[model samples]
Target: MMTTIAAARSAGATRWTLTSLSLSMLLSSLGTSIANVGLPTLSEAFNAPFQSVQWVVIAYLLAITALIVSVGRLGDITGRRRLLLIGIGLFTLASALCAVAPTLNLLITARALQGLGAAIMMALTLAFVSDAVPKPRIGRAMGMLGTMSAIGTAMGPTLGGLLIYGFGWRAIFLITVPLGLLTGWLAYRWLPADSAKSGARRSGFDVPGTLMLVVMLTAYGLAMTIGRGSFGWLNSALLVFAGVALWMFVSIEKRVASPLIHLEMFRDPDLSACLAMSALVTMVMMATLVVGPFYLSEALELDAVGVGLVMSVGPLGAALTGVPAGRVVDRFGARRMTVSGLAAMVIGCFALSITPAEFGIGGYVVAVAVITSGYALFQTANNTAVMADVIADQRGVISGLLNLSRNLGLVSGAAALGAVFALASRSVGSNLAHPDAIAHGMQTTFAVALMLMGMALVIALRRLKAHGR
Candidate 1:
């Protein structure tokens, strides 16, 4: 066993060696959210409607979600290091294109390409981490990874705001380019170059499964985008697309051997529960990401900068807890940490829900801070649990599924919460600016999220009991 672990390490799996990889992953993850602040700039520069410009964000997410599983599977079959280099190279170039895009359509296209690059980066990073780290230390490594994610998520808007304020929206993309290039250069020097599992292997890509998953996610993302704001719940198209796509997705997963997502992975209580928990936690956490801006702007009567400042609190909480949560997971177990963290989140959300629109900005900031901290704890614990149980070979596929859940949660949070708020607002007086209505919708979403957290608790009870953390 010792020799095998060492050989795996020689296969480019080591804790200290992965510093570059983790940094690389962090930059790529940050790249994903960094564009949010520039959407208005993009709208004005290209003379495009904000609604249409929204697709620029949606397109990247869609592409990444659709391609990540396949890309991860491919990394396993081929080589993780090789894929990482390619992903970084492509992502860097795509950033350049986004910086120089002449039209909204062009920017959207470039962003889509960037998302594809990001998918590869994310998938390979997971696979490589799994290959490099020992089972005993996996929790620590996962904790660091979680910290990076929390930081990136928190900093994207803040960083984007500063860049846009300083040099226009183009600066947002430009900021990433130099860092990406530097990361790429460092990656080429420090990253392992192991040979892939060489073969003209007969098992090819599961085209049907891939296509079905893409269709399902695209339809779902589209439905969320349209259904959340202006599109009514009674829209037949949303229902039809959602139903059909979901059915097809499950069917494809069951039939395909090398399915886009392995169905059997769900059998693991830890994996299923953690994924679900992460999804729920993200939904609740991101509700702030989606709804907080509106609250600050419409309800509190603040500008974009003030709104961004208020929203930054949660990420700050996450950053503070990230490393510590991972350590807790390593020493104790996922069960206690996850439950406690989520409980914090629930409390935070409840507090925020009842906060009067007229409440002081300081009150809002404190609530946001709690939300951020809770999510950070949950994420660190959750990530440690998932990676701890899985074998190295399946790491990419598992990571891809995890990423899929997270993005789905974001889509769901933004859409479902937005729709609820819209309806509640309209029912009262078609005035979305009403704080009471927005708070109502946010609370409802929090309740649903709380239910999901309960489910996660059950999973932890069943799954982690025998594992003996």
Candidate 2:
């Protein structure tokens, strides 16, 4: 009777919500990886140094890291659905700007704007999905979202290659226009208008805290970026600015009525430890991704399409394993899966470190697949654990924090690991363009990755012991 009708409505809502959110996830994640393949093409097109052209990705990541926390808080206050729609619309507009930009500066600026919209959308995704699904099914819903993310990651390089070959680099950005529009329209039609709880009044936005956080992340990101270059003194100054901004952020958060971040959330050892582990895992994983194309192109003498096809294996592995990993987390708990994943990553890194340059594409494909399988397991479990640790009301902020952690990892991995590769290649008396140099640099990078994975494993073990897991 009445109960049956209510159940039917609930099921319909869940299906629509999952579809819309998953599509949004796919679009946003696609943006993260797609532009990577275009970096060299853009450099040649604009007649810019690789260092300057790298800002295309850095600008996007910097904006996301800086604004995610504040945007998440705003979503909580106003409404997640409202923020999501705005984010999608803004992202679509920015993508259009990026496609037609006449100069490197304009393209970078557009990317920054795109990242802002992406942060808003990313910050709301888990919150919105969690709201729609039942508690017991959270793991599965997260799995589905993770699968979409994996698909985007897997497809980005291959798709970018094909588009670039047929059209140009601009086609990469242009492709998103239609997809973004469709995702937005579907979201508007299917998503609940009032997904957020009623009676949650809007508090004053934390303007000072927001500004301080932006300064901190910006300074830190800039320092890391510059540190990768020959500008040592400028990098030092940026680091100092970063330190001061961090102090100001901590001081202001304690006094603000509506803080951008709830500082007290870190008091839970589980949350703090999980965040640290997540950051480390992402750092290693992204470092590998940043360096992989170079190894394929320089060491193995592969073209862009060949490199894309090879790199696709990693995310393909992730896409295949993501759902099962999530279900395993639900059944066996997060700690076991996390530790197992880290161990697998350690093995993968070791394999890459020792692999001979003569092994070529087949070896790399296998190594990357293994590494990304570990990433899939670790991320799905770690994300589930992070969400489970927070209270219902704090989900928005926690989601932001989780995303910020990963974004920081991405920024650091690119800068720090890129520096390592550069230095190691030089030590071999050849630049990265030389096959011998590429081999040395990649080996060094993977060795470093192995150490980081080991560190993560130790952290996970301690976390398990602390929680009596």
TM-score of each: 0.88, 0.92
lDDT of 1 by residue, 1-469 (tens): 9999888666563544567667766776787778877788888888888788888888888888778877876666666677778888888899999999888889899999999899988777766665666666666676677677667877998888888888899888888788888878777777666654522332655778877777777777777766336666654586588689779888977887767667777887667777887777777766777767776787678897787777767766776777777777767777777777777777777677667666668878887787777777777677766666666557767877877888888877777766665565566556677766665555555555556556655665565565663
Deviation from native of the Cα of residue 469 in model 1, angstroms: 7.3
lDDT by residue for model 2 (245-352), tens: 999999999998878788988897878887888788888888777789889998999997787778778888989988888788778888888887888898899999
How close is each model in CA RMSD to the real structure? 3.8, 2.4
Report the Cα lDDT for residue 107, model 1. Answer: 89
lDDT at 279, model 2: 84
The C-alpha stretches of model 1 lying farther than 4 A from their native spots are 1-16, 195-204, 232-239, 249-257, 357-359, 426-429, 435-448, 461-469
Q: Count residue pairs with overlapping backbones in model 2.
A: 0
Error of 1 at 462 (Å): 4.5
